[model samples]
Target: MPLSDKHPTVKRRRSQLLNHFLAFFVFAVIVVPVNFFTTPDHVWFFWPLVGWMGPLALHTAYAMGLFDRRD
Candidate 1:
């Protein structure tokens, strides 16, 4: 069965999914290593914390309109 456009949540979820994928790809391949190397060794916990939280945090903000663009 095909998804109907009548459900607003479906559209929101679809948008969220696209944002999540884009966020994951950008952070995983580009941002992770840069932070891993440049960060100080004393803050070892920061790396994993940032690595996991960054994408979720950013995406959540975007979806919530906190980090949205006007253009």
Candidate 2:
């Protein structure tokens, strides 16, 4: 076996990570403009984007093997 992971679940996590990134990109694209035009002062769009980023970051770390340990 290789030093890296070779599990089906890891593969799924990587795929999900990509999909999540794409979805978040689309969400930001849509919300930013709407928020800007409707209420430019508050910039409420920033909150949701930041909130969504936390999960994405954790997902990315897992896919990158940041939490993996071999014994």
Candidate 3:
């Protein structure tokens, strides 16, 4: 069953997810240039981005009720 978006729990969950996404974006902005300048040949920023994004994607899906049971 898809939870109504107006539900308090769902609203809070999405709000928190938004905050996490913002933080991740900020982190990437800071890390990418630093990683590139510090280690020009050994670029490694993608690793962290992939690692965090996978779980965030899952969280987003969950918040969207993709995994919820049908009633």
lDDT of each: 0.64, 0.86, 0.90
Off by over 4 Å in 3: none
Residues 1-71 of candidate 3: C-alpha lDDT, one tens digit per residue: 55677999899989988998998999999999999899989989999999999989998988887887786
Candidate achieving higher lDDT, 2 or 3:
3
Clashes of each: 0, 0, 1
For model 2, the stretches where C-alpha displacement exceeds 4 angstroms are: 1-11
The predicted structure with the larger TM-score, 2 or 3, is 3
Superposed on all Cα atoms, the candidates' RMSDs to the truth, in angstroms, are: 8.1, 2.6, 1.4
- Considering only N, C-alpha and C atoms within 3 Å, which residue pairs clash in candidate 2? none
Q: Write the per-residue lDDT of candidate 2 for residues 1-71, one digit (tens) a residue.
A: 22335677777877888998999999999999999999988879989999999999998988877787766
lDDT of model 2, residue 40: 89
Predicted structure with the largest lDDT when compared to the true one: 3
What's the candidate order when arranged by decreasing lDDT? 3, 2, 1
Error at 61, model 2, angstroms = 0.4
Error of 2 at 57 (Å): 0.7
lDDT of 1 at 6: 59
